[model samples]
Target: MKATQELHNLGQSLWLDNITRGLLTDGTLARYINELVVTGLTSNPTIFDQAIRTTAFYDDDIRKKTAAGKSTEDIFFELAIDDLTKAAELFRPDYDATGGVDGVVSLEVSPLLADDADGTIHAAEKLHAQANCPNLLIKIPGTAAGVPAIEETIFAGVPVNVTLLFSCEQYLAAAEAYLRGIERRINAGLDPHINSVASLFVSRWDHAIGDKVPAELRNRLGIAVAQRTYKAYCELYDSPRWSKLAAAGARPQRLLWASTGTKDPNAPDTLYVQALAAADTINTIPEKTLLAFADHGKVSSTLPADGGDAEKVLAAFRAAGIDDQALAAQLQLEGAESFNKSWHALMQCIVEKGQSKSTGTQAEQL
Candidate 1:
C-alpha cells in the first residue's frame, strides 16, 4: 500500500492544502479524492491568489461579475464560494461516512481582518451561511484578536478551522476558545456537536529555524512541536473538563497539521508527513507533497500518545538558545502579514483584470 494509505489506515486524515478552479473543472480534485486518499482540502488567500492570476478558468466569471459592477472582493468571494461549494459536494460522502469528523474543506476569511475580531466574526458567518455545506469549515486564524471571534462563531454553530497556529501554546489557546464556545452552547440549551479543528503549522517552524539550529537538528523543530501539541491534545481530550463536554455531545476539537510540506531540499519530501502520522489528527499537504509521499514515503511508528521524547528534543532546541514560545508568536505575526500581502495582491490582480477586460485588452500581457 502507498504510505498515504498506510497513514490513513493508522487513522490519520490526509487533507490536501490546495484548491483551484482548474483542479475542479478538470476533475483533478475528484481524482485526488479517489486515488490519493485525500479526505479534505484547505484554501487560503495565497492559494486562491495564485489560482486566479495564472488561469483563464475564472475569466468568464470575472467578465460577467465585472460587467455587473461587483467590487473585486465581491467577485473574489463569489468565485471562491462556487469552487468550494463544488469541492464540498465531492467530499460529502466521506463527510457523511465519518460523521463529520474526517471529510472537510476549509476556506479562510480575509487575512486583512486578522486584527478585527468583529469583522472576522462577521465574515465567518457570511461565508458559512453562503457555503451551505455541512462539511465546509470557515477558517479563522488563532491570533489574539481571532480567538474571541472563533469562540463566538462556534457558539453560533459554524464549524471552524483554526489556522496559522505556530506552537503548542497557540494550539491550546485556540482549542480553549473552541471549547468555550461549545460550553456556552451547552449552557444555552443548544447542540454541543459543532465541529472544529485547531491547525498548528509544521514546516514553517523548521524553515524559520533551519539556519539557526545545528545541522544535525535541521528539519526537526516542526515535528517536535507537533508531537508536543499532539500530546497536549490527547491529555485535553481525556481530562475531566473535556469528558463533561463530551458527555453533553460536544466533539473534541481535532488537531490539524498545516504547512506539512518539507521546505528543506536536503530533507525527505515527506519528512513532516511521515513523522507526524498520529491517529485522530489531520495532515494537510500540498499536492506535490502528497504525491511524493504516495510514491516513496515510509510509515513506521505512530506518534506516541504520551508525546514521547518530544520534550527531550525540545530541550535540545532550548539549549541551542531557541525559545519555542517566543518564536511561535513571531511566526504567527509573520504568517498574518504574509496572508495580508497575498490578499492585497489577489484583490489587485482581480481589479487589474477587470480593468483590462473592460478596456478590450486581456490581462494576460500585464
Candidate 2:
C-alpha cells in the first residue's frame, strides 16, 4: 500500500499543497486522487505566481482578460477560480462520502489583506460566492486582525482555512474564532455546521531554530508544537461546550499541519509527516514530500492524545532562549510579507506578458 493510503487510513488526511492549470490539464491531479490518496489541495500566491510565470497554458486567457481591461489581480483570481473550481469537482466524491469532512481545496484571500480584517472578510465572501463549490475553503491568515475576519467569515457561512498559525496558542485562537462563528449561527437560527480548519504550520519552526537548539531538539519543535496542539484539539472536541454545539449540529474545526515539507536536507524527509500523524487532522505536503513518503516513510506511532512530552520539548527550546510565542509571531509576519512579495511579482509578470503580447500584435500589423 502507498504510505499516503496508510496515512489516510490512520485518519489523517493527505492534501497536496499545490495546484496548477498544467496539473489539471495533464490529469496529474486526478491521478493523485485515484492513486496517492490525495483527497484535497491547497494554493497560495507563491504557487500561482510560479504557475502563471512558467506556463504558457494561461497566456491566451491572460491576453483576453488583459484586453478586457481587467486588473492583474482580477485576472489572477479568474484564473485561480477556474482551476480551483475544477479541482473541487474532482474531489467532489470524497467530499460527498465524508459529508464534507475531507476533500476540501483551499484558496487564500489576498495576502496583502492579511492585516485588513474588513478587506479580508469582503474578499473571502466574494471569492466564496465566486467559487460556488461546496468543498472549497477560503484561507485566511491567523494574524490578530485575521482572527476577527475568520470568525466573521465563518459566521457568514463561508468555510475557511485559517493559515499561517505557528504555535498551539495561535491554533487555539483560530479554533475559538471558528467556534464563535458557529455558535453565532446557531443563535441566529442558522445551520451550525460551518466547516473550517485551523492550519498550524510545521517544519518552519525547526528551520527557524535549527541552529539555536540542541541536537536533541533539532527538527523536533515542529512536531512537539503539533502534538501539543493536537491534545488541545481533542480536548476541545470532548469539551461539554463543544459537545453541546455538536449536538446542535455544529462540527469541530479540524487541525491542519502546513509547511510539512522538510526544510533541512539533513533532516528526515518524512520527519514532519511521521511525527504529526493523528486522526481527524490533516497534513498538507509538498509534491516532493509526498513522493518521498511513498518511497521510504514509516509511521512508528501516532501522536499521543495526552500531548506526550510536548512541554518538555518546548522547555528545552525555551532554555535555549527561543521564545516560541515570539518566534511564531515573527514567522506569521514574515510569511505574510513573503506572500506579498510573490503577489507583487505575479502582477508584474502578468503586466509584462500582456504588454509583450500587445506589442507583438502591433508589429505584425506593420
Candidate 3:
C-alpha cells in the first residue's frame, strides 16, 4: 500500500497545499484523490500567483473579466472561486462520507485586510456566499485583528481556516475565537456544528531558526513546536468547555499542520510528515512532499497525545537562546507580510496579462 493510504488509514488527513488550473483540468488532483489519498486542498495568494503567472490556463478567463470591467482583485476572486468551487465539488464525496471532517478546500481572504476586522468579516461572508460550497473554508489569519473577524465570521455561519499561527499560544487564541463564535451560536439557538480549522504552520519555524540553532537542533524545532501544540489541542478537547460544546453537536476545531514541506535540503523529505502524524488533525503538504511521501514515506508512530518530550526539546532550545514566544510573534508578522507581497505580485500578473492581451488584439487589427 502507498504510504499516503497508510497515513489516511492511521486517521490523519493529507491535503494538497496547492491548486492550479493544470492540475484540475488534467485530472492530477483527481488522481491524487483516488490513489494518493489527498482528500482535500488549500490555496493562498502565493499558490494562486504562481499558478496564474506560470500558465496560460487563466488567460481567457482574465480576458473575459477584464472586458467586463472587473477590478483586478475582483477578477482574481472570480478566478479563485471558480477553481475552489470545482475542487470542492471533486472532494464532495469524501466530505459527505466523513461528515465534513476531511474533505475541505480553503481560500484565504485578502491579505490586504489582514488588519481590518470589519473588512475581513465582510470579505469572508461575501466570498463564502459567492463560492457557495459548504465544504469551503475562508482562511483568516490568526492575527489580533483576524481573531475578532474569525469569531464574527463563524458566528455568522461561515466556516473558517485560521491561518498564520506559529505557536501553541496562537493556536489557543484562534481556538478561543472559534469557540466564542460557536458559543454565541449556541446562545442564539443556532447550530454549533460550523466547521473550522486552526492552521499552525510547521516548517517555517525550523527555517527561520535553522541557521541560528545548533546542528543537532536543525529541523527539529518545528516538530517540537507541533508536538507541544498537539498536546494542547488534545487537552483543549478534553476540557469541560469543549465537552459541553461537543455534547451540543459542535465539532472540535481541528488542528491543521501547514507548511509541512521540509525546507532544509539536508533533512529527509518526509521529516515533517513522519514526525507530525496524529489522528483528528490535518496536514496540508506541498505537492512535492506528497509525491515524495507516497514514493517512500514511513510513519513509524503517531505523535503522542500528551506531548512526549516536547517540553524537554523546547527547554533545550530555550537553553540555546531561542525565545519561543518572541519568535512566534516575529514569524506571524513575517508571514502576513509575505502573503501581502504575494497578493501584490498576483495583481501585477493579472494587470500585465490583461494589458498584453489587449495590445495583441490592437496589433492584429492594425
Candidate 4:
C-alpha cells in the first residue's frame, strides 16, 4: 500500500492543502480522493490569491458578480462558497461513513476580522449558513480575539477549523473554546456533536528559527512542539470533563497538523509529515508534499502518547537560547500578518479581474 493509505489506516487523516478551480474541473481533486486517500482539504486567502491570479477559471463568475455591482469581498465569497459546496458534495460519502469526524473542507473568513471578535463571529456564522454544507468548516484564527468567536460560532452550530495556532498554549486555548461551546449547547438543549479541528502550524517554527539554531537542531523544533501539543490533546480528550461531555454527545475536537510542508531544502520533504503521524489527528499537506510522501515516505512511528522526548528536545532548544514561549507569541503574530497580506492581495486580484474586460465568454466548464 502507498504510505498515504498506510497513514490513513493508522487513523490519521491526510488532507490536501491546495485548492484551485482547475483541480476540481480537471478531475485532479477526485483522483487525489480516490487514489491518495485524501479525505479532506483546507484553503486560505493565500491559496485563493494564487488560484485567482494564475487562472481564468473564475472569470465568468467574476464578471457576473461584478456586473451585479457586488463588492470585491462579496464576489470572492460567492465564488468560494460555490467551489466549497461542490467539494463538499464530493466528500459527502466519506463524511457520512465516518459520522462527520473526517472528510471535511475548510474556508477561512477575512483576515481583516482577525482582531475583531464580533466580526469574526458574524462572518463565521454567515459563511457557514451561506455554504450550507455540513462537511464544510469555516476557519477562525486561534488568536485571543478569535477564541471567544470560535466558542460562539460553535454554539451557533457551525463547524470550525481553528487556524494560526503555533504552540501548545494556543491549541489548548482553542480546545477550551470548543469545549465551552459544546457545554453551552448541552445546557441549552442544542446538539453537542458539532465537529471542529484545532490546527497547530508546524513548519513555520523551523523556518523562523532554522538559521538561529545549530545544524542538528534544524527542522526539529516543529516536530517537538507538535509532540508536546499532541500529549495535551490526548490528555484533554481522555479527561473526566471530556468523558462527561462525550456522554452528552459532544465530539472531541481533533488536533490537526497544518503547514507540514518542509521549508529547509536539505531536510527530507516528508520530515514533518512522517514525524507527526499520530492516530486521530489530521495532517494537511501541500500537494507537492503529499505526492512526495505517497511516493517514498514511511510511517516511521506513531507519535509518542506520553510526548516521548518532547520535553528533552525543548530543553535543548532553551539551552541554545531559543525561548519557545516567546517565539510562539511572535509566530502567531506573524502568521496573522501573513494572512492579512494574502487577503488584501486576493481582494485586489478580484478587483482587477472583475473589471468589465471581457475574456471571450470565459470558456466552458470554468
Q: Which model scores highest in TM-score?
A: 4
- Compute each candidate's TM-score over C-alphas: 0.97, 0.96, 0.97, 0.98
lDDT per residue as tens, model 4, 59-123: 87897799899999999999988888888877888999999999989999999898999999999
Candidate 1's residue-wise lDDT over 237-354, tens digit each? Answer: 9999999999999888999999999888898898988899899999999999999998999998889988888899999999999999999999999999999999999999888777
* Segments in model 1 whose C-alpha atoms lie over 4 Å from true places: 358-366
Output the lDDT of residue 271, model 4.
Answer: 92
Residue lDDT tens for model 3, 169-245: 99999999999999999999999999999999999999998789888888888899999999999999999999899
| CA lDDT scores, all candidates in order | 0.91, 0.90, 0.93, 0.93
lDDT ranking, best first:
3, 4, 1, 2
lDDT score, candidate 1: 0.91
- Residue 254, model 3, lDDT: 93
Model 1 residue pairs with clashes = none
Looking at candidate 3, what is the lDDT of residue 167?
97
Of 1 and 4, the candidate ranking higher by TM-score: 4
Give the per-residue Cα lDDT of candidate 1 at 333: 98
Q: How far is 249's C-alpha from truth in model 1 (Å)?
A: 1.1
Best by lDDT: 3
Candidate 4: stretches off by over 4 Å: 361-366
